[model samples]
Target: MRILIAGAGIAGLTTALSLHAAGLDEIRLVDAAPEIRPLGAGINLLPNAVRELADLGLDAAVGAAAVPTTELVYFSRHGDVIWREPRGRAAGHRWPQLSVHRGHLQMVLLAAAEERLGRGCVRADARVTDFCRLPTGRVRVTLAHRTGDTSTTTEVDALIGADGIRSGVRRVLFPDEGPPVWQRQVVWRGITKIPPFADGRSMFVGGDSTWKVVAYPIAPLPDAAGLVDTNWAVSRTFVPGEVVDRAGWDRVVDPAKLLAALDGWVFDSLDVGALIAAAAPFEQAMVDRDPLPRWTFGPVTLVGDAAHAMCPMGSNGTTQAIIDARALASAVAVEPDISTAFVAYERDRRERMTLLQNCNRALGPEVVVAMADRARSVIRPGPSARDLDRELAEISRRYAELGGFDVAAANAASSYSVRRRPHSARPAQQPAGS
Candidate 1:
């Protein structure tokens, strides 16, 4: 079947690679971006995602470019440790949680798509305008040039939308969905070269929802000064009704304002102030669409952020996207017809992502901090720190399970493998490397 995937970002590119590995050869990718620019800050691939990448023969290459996150630690606004736990292979999983630059990861997936599917398979600067189903049961996708010139159309047997949170495909499918639900929380994220941090590969999340900080090294190895590139994010929240008219947030912002909020967030091991001071910050509105009723509609379906743009809490946004790639590709490989594949894919993914969306809205394990805050009360105390730690550990495990990262199960299951790679899927002469 001829397949067209929109938006060659992480989700779209990975989808292309997964489909090729599944033995589907007639696949093409396009993106709204005018060129292949590796844009964005750091991103994490939980064990679930890393496992699938390993199945694609990408573990070593991507891992080499990423910091294997050894632990996940949480702190209160006052810098007191709330909970801590080992992560990835450090936690006994078969795969390691990867903290890599999002742009770098995209480049990795893009390179893989090119090598495996042949170059020029992904058409950049081609933006999808609309789609229509032909009487023959094929899809006709209208592509407009980035320069707004003459438009063109391509016919494909199937279409998958991985176009990101503001997906036009989603708008076409759910016109009344309105704009993405914005939480009025703006995230200031950036990378900075700083002295080695805790464990050199641990991830740190500080403060409550109102104000927060997340810092982690994306580089597995340090540089000349024993320093590494660390990604730190600070968030500023708006009071109710404050962001109703807000329009843009994913733009560069003055870090000075964000830095001030970290005035006293310094820890003996981490200097939040220094990290903020050293990096330029880019602001992003914390946004997610309400879970859709359905992601697959006939031969057309949605993937990744296009399907479920949940809050970037719980580190599930990207994780779920790659997971979508795995499940969708697997379904396509097993099902007899295109429609069944789409239905099976949706059945396999929708409920889980819906639950994840809800869990992330509740802040996942971060809710434990709220519990701890209530614990300080004189009348009705909440869980003590010791008890909170135990509770938080359960919450973490629950999310791990929901996110498809059961340590024991993953370690025991046969390695995630591509069941097929039809001859047509590979070019006669692959570049001498992956």
Candidate 2:
């Protein structure tokens, strides 16, 4: 079936790969960005997604561009440990979880798409302005050019809106819904070349619900001073009625402000002040849309942030999108009717994503830390700490289970076997996005 995928970021690109592997290649990808460029900071590929990528034969490409995270640790605002868990292969998952620069991961997926789907099959400077069902039982998507007032339209058997939070396709479908809704939370994201924190492959989260910082190494450990690029983010809660303009906020912000918000967040390993001083931070309002009742609308459906944008609480955004692509492709591969595939895909994904959205809104497993922090003054040591630890660990395990990726189950599941791509084959294409 001919398909048009909106947005060439992770979700759109991964969808292309999944469809291609399923023996369908009449897929076209487009992004609003004039050209694909390395954008954003670090992203996590949970074992479930790692398995999906391995199935598509891009594990080596991703491995070369990213670091395999070994463990995750959480700390309270006072720097007390809340929870720690092994990740990926370390956690016994068949596939290792990867933390990589978002742009780098996109480029890796882009190269694979171009190599397998043909170069330029993924277009830049194209934006889907609107889409609708056609008389011929197909979907027609309209594109507004970036450089001109000109626009183009195409008809396909199906359309996948893998476009991100500010998705035009979503706007057309829900004009009344408006832009992404933001809570009273604002987050500042930045990366720095600094001394590696903790284990070179570890990721850490410190602080409570109202304020927090997530830091992780985006690349392999450095050779010398142990300096590597580390991605860091700090989020603060604001007044509920606070106003934040989405268009006005670029990824860049003053580092001093971020440093101020994290004034006391000095841990033994991660130096919050030093990292923030390394560079400016990109400011963003912590926002998400209320989960929709259905993502399937005839031959059109949504994926990734477009489908269900959530808080960064659990770091589940990209993983959920990858799984969405996997399920959609699997559905399409087995179902003869594109419409039926849309139903199956949504059926398999919507409820899970909805649960994820709720979990994130309530701060997922991390909420326990905030609760513990508030009760710390009255709560004594000993059993109190042990009980909180037990609760946090269960929350962590429950999130993985809720997301359909129980760590142990993921490790034990027999992975799909695909022929290894020859080492002598073409090297990874460094697109203009590079």
Overall lDDT per candidate, in order of appearance: 0.80, 0.80
Candidate 2, 226-246: lDDT as tens digits: 689998888777656665555
Top candidate by lDDT: 1
The residue-by-residue lDDT of candidate 1 on 1-434, one tens digit each, is 68899999888988989888888888899898889888988989888888888888888888888999999887777777777789988899878889999998999899999999999999988988899777677778999886767689998878899999989778878878888887667778889999888779889987755787888999888898888999887776677866432443666766677666777676448889888887778777788889988887678899999999998877778888988988888888777667677788899889989998888777766676566555643123355545656677788879878877779766654333557845432221211110
lDDT of 1 at 307: 96
Alpha carbon RMSD to native, model 2: 6.4
Segments in model 1 whose C-alpha atoms lie over 4 Å from true places = 241-248, 377-383, 414-416, 421-434
Pick out the ten consecutive residues of candidate 1 with the lowest summed lDDT: 425-434
What TM-score, over all chains together, does every model reach? 0.92, 0.91
- Which one wins on TM-score? 1
